[model samples]
Target: MKLLRLVLPGLTMIAVTYGLARFSFGLLLPDIKESLGMSEAVSGIISSLFYFAYCVMIVLSTVITTREGPRRMILLAGASAFLGLLVMAVTPNVWVLAVGVFLAGASTGLASPPYGAAISLWMSRAEQGKGNTWINSGTSFGIALSGAGAILLSPYWRVTYGIYAVLALLALLWNFRVIPRAEKRWKVTFEKGNLSLKGIKGANSLITASLILGISTAAFWTFSRSFIEIAGDYRSWELSGFWVVIGIFGVLGGFSGSLIEKYGLAFAYKLGSLSIASASILISIAPEKWLVSFASAGLFGGAYIFLTGVLLVWGIRVFIKNASLGIGIPFLLLAVGQVIGSSLAGLFIGAWGYAPAFILYGFIGIAAVFIGPKKNKAED
Candidate 1:
């Protein structure tokens, strides 16, 4: 029961950080671009800036959380998010929105590492996969809600931002009330570790996997709405439906803790890599609307989250001494890939069209299979 209590709060934190702070961009992108009078390429660049800040802050966040404890970090994260939303709601210019998103991304970055670490500390090694999945599931749920809600509340972006700000504020209060503070000496222990070069090989492999994953994932995420708009000849409703479908499958992906547990991380990673490649190809070639959209969403959503879960667990297991750094390294690389993909998406779409870009992303996914870590006796 106590464990369940802990899990709920952690999950809530993930939902707020990921769903509201991060994933909401997908839902609100069209509105934001229209309202700000920005081109698609510029909009993508703005969104990429958020990820850029997020990537830089990951390591710093890990250090702070390790030293100060997750409770304090959560509070700080919530505060930053609230401030960012406030800026977005009221700011008069695109540059200001970029600054707001950067702050918001950094704030959310602080929550993830400590939250993952804290959850790991609370759960036994045998149950880590399930525990992490439950927390991540919150993100899926939040994405579903935010996407659907934003569409339903369209033409009211400012109001939506206000509501999201309120959510973050509430999360801050909850964190203060529910999470316990750490001892003063936790900082000392957190700082005592000596950096080593031993994890470089594993980190490199993880970074490669992350980059491929990001390219594949970003292509879908950044372009899904546009794709639907063009292919389905539909509006916000279809895009919302797609997100809802993805979230449903995303929940299933989260519950796939057993798959990771039984088959091991390598198997899960390979499955995700293959699924992403296959899905991208199918989405690229399919002429039928329902088949293309639903299949694309379900397959990509499931595979992406599954791979994320697998890689995160694998990082913690393989680099136990510096698990936070291990996780942060891959995430940073992933963010870079997202920025690159987003920046180029408009160019590719305008020049060659969606099918070609989708095909290219599919190849990237296929490459991930080869870049992934091979089975080794030592790895085992």
Candidate 2:
């Protein structure tokens, strides 16, 4: 019962942050663009800004988690999500919308690190990996729920976002009740010129792996549905179904921890990198094929979530003493990579068209399989 209580709140909190706050933007953008007379160029810039906010918050979150601890930071993450959604629900202009997007994006950054701490602090050693991955899978739940709501609540972006705010508010309340409070704040000082990679082993490899994976995944997340819709001529609801399948299979990604427990991080990471790259290749080659489309969605969704789970465990393993930064730095690098890759993908699509651009990204994913040293071992 104690473990269940912690998992539910963590799951819902992640759903709100990753699913509602982050990915739903892509889903809602068509309506938002139509309503606001936005251009692709401008929207891309806004998207980059969203990632920029995510990157900044993730960097700051590590510091805050170090000084204040994870419980307090988690609450702040939920609050940021609520405020962001509320702003989006009522925003009358693009600038305001951008503000909302940034805050919402930051929530994902803020959400990640603390949970690492939470699990390390609360869950037993045997249970921790599963709990962390299970919580991570919450993003799938949020995405699926949003897709369903989008189908049912057609053409009401504001209402959709408003509901997201209310759900976030409830999630905030639930998390507040379940997540314990921080003890008195502590202060730590870092020298100006020198950096501290103290207590974190294999930081370089982790950053490298995360950055490569992030770049590879960016093209698909930002533009795959667009290609399927435009090139494949999918009916609107079919696209919704596409997203639904992704989320559903992503939930299945909770098994990543099981895979890691049985096989280990190197095996899991290699499998995920190959699977994710294959997903891109699968979709890019046959965007119009219904069978392939759904299969690609499933593969990408499961593999994407699985790979992030691998990272989470890997981070915790290496940065054993600093669990929050363990999670934060790798994820932050991934986000930073996304910021660069997503931006580059936008330009690449303009010049090269979707198939070639996607194929290039897929190749990069394949390369990611060999990023680090021969071993790719996680510290015990």
Candidate 3:
């Protein structure tokens, strides 16, 4: 029961940081672009800036959470998210919007590492993996909430964001009350920096795979809703429903820890990555087919979260000495690849078209499955 209590706040934290702060940008991109008088390429650049900030903060989070011990930084994550969304809600121009994007992006990075440390400190070995992954599934929860909001709010994007900001503020309060404060030394001392990741087996394979997966998923997150809206000529409610299906099904990914215990971790990773790639192809080619498009969203949402869970476990195994380092390294690299992918994908789409870009990214996701660890590995 106590363990369950700890997990809830972490879950809410992820929901706010990833779902509201980061992913909502994609969901609301059409409204935002129209209101700001921005082009797709510019939207892509802003999205890339979000990932760039994410990559940077996730790296810094590794060090800060190590020294600060999660609580303060977790507060920072929530605060940044709330303030970021508030700014985005009120922003009158593109430049101010970018500032909000960067801060909101950073919130996800800040939210991630602390929760792992918190769970590690609170949960038993039997509970740790499940708790962590369930919290990770909060991304889906946030998505669901945002989707519901979009449906109800309709054409009011700014009003939608303002509500999201209130959600973040509530999340902040809940987490502040729940997560324990750091010890005296935890506040003052810096984590001892080794500046080395020597002798970690399969490190290369893990990072390579993360970067590959990141690049592949970038286009989907950045443009899926807008693409669907354009390609299928979907109504606002239809798009909202599509987003909700993804979120509802994505909740299943929380069980990935159990899946790993039943099947091998490597098998789970391959299956999830493959499913994600297939999702892009399925929807991209058949946008006019309502059933196929919805199914694709559902598949991609579940697979994306499941794959991320796999990466979280994989990272911790490779860097067992520090939970923050483990989570940060894989996620940070993934964001780096996203920064690259997000920066360029709009150009590709503009030059060719959306379907071709999705097909291209889907193939890249397929390629990710083969970048497996070189050695025969035991299940973690």
Candidate 4:
């Protein structure tokens, strides 16, 4: 019970930070754009700024996580996120809002690596899958909560931002109180060279898979609510309900970490990726059907995040010496793909409609299967 208490707070902090930092932007984007008199393209770019900063901060986050350890990094991240959210709450213009988003992204970037590192450190090897899942589920929960909160408090996005700010502050406090600082210290080493394409070896497959996953997942996440709105059959709360259902299933999926241990990361990844591809197709073709969208959300949320946990574990195992750096590389690639996908989504939806856009995303997932590593049966 005592151990569970210590771990639960850390997991909650990660979930809250990720939920607000990444998923909330999509949930709140439509309202924010409308209030600011911006077009969908401009809105997409503004939201993409978060990912831009996130990608840039991955290197810094990796360094910090390696140096100071996960606990302190998380505290700093929470503080940064709090300030960023406050800035967004007070901003009067779109440009200012973009700056706020950038800061928020940087805060999350700082928080995520350390949080992931901390989970890896604290959880038993057998429990790592479930631990990571719980941490990741915070993002999904945040998304659902923010969406529901926005609908309940319509036309007052500032209030939602204020709520996020307060949550971040609480996370910061809890982290400092509960998470013990790392005692081990090691000399931080960087290769006497620039961060180039060549610095990363045998990481191509990971990066490629991450990019595909990012593009497809971001497309679904950013537009899922909007898709429901445009389909003209569901209430706003109903759309939010779908996300809430996804969040519930997400928690169930995340707690199945032990299952991944038995099945192997590669097998789990393949299954999750295939599930996402199928779910995307169903949701796209049957946009007006509530059950289809609801089922799709559950499957996609569960499978995508479950796969992420698997991949992170695999990366850590593959690059034990530079585990954080290895993890950051794939995240960086994921961020780049998300930015590209989100930026293009509005144009694609306008030109080709949601079905085609979803089809494109599904194809990206299918492409990932080929790019992933293929070792012999003996290697497994």
Each candidate: what lDDT?
0.71, 0.84, 0.83, 0.70
Q: In model 3, where do residues sit more than 4 Å from their true spots?
A: 39-42, 184-195, 373-379
Could you estimate the TM-score for every candidate?
A: 0.89, 0.93, 0.91, 0.87
Pick the lDDT winner: 2
The segments of candidate 2 whose C-alpha lies over 4 angstroms from its true place after superposition are 184-195, 372-380
Consecutive 10-residue window with the lowest summed lDDT within model 3: 184-193
Q: Which candidate is the best by TM-score?
A: 2
Q: Which stretches of candidate 1 lie over 4 Å from their true place?
A: 39-42, 184-201, 376-380
Model 4, CA-based lDDT: 0.70
Residue-level lDDT tens digits of model 3 in 154-246: 468899889999999999999988887665232223243433588777788888999999999988877787788788867778988898888
Worst 10 residues of 1 by lDDT: 184-193
lDDT of 4 at 171: 80
- For model 4, the stretches where C-alpha displacement exceeds 4 angstroms are 1-6, 39-42, 120-123, 184-202, 373-380
| Candidate 2: tens digits of C-alpha lDDT, residues 92-142 | 999999999999999998899888877777667788788888898998988
Q: Give model 1's TM-score versus the native structure.
A: 0.89
TM-score winner between candidates 2 and 4: 2
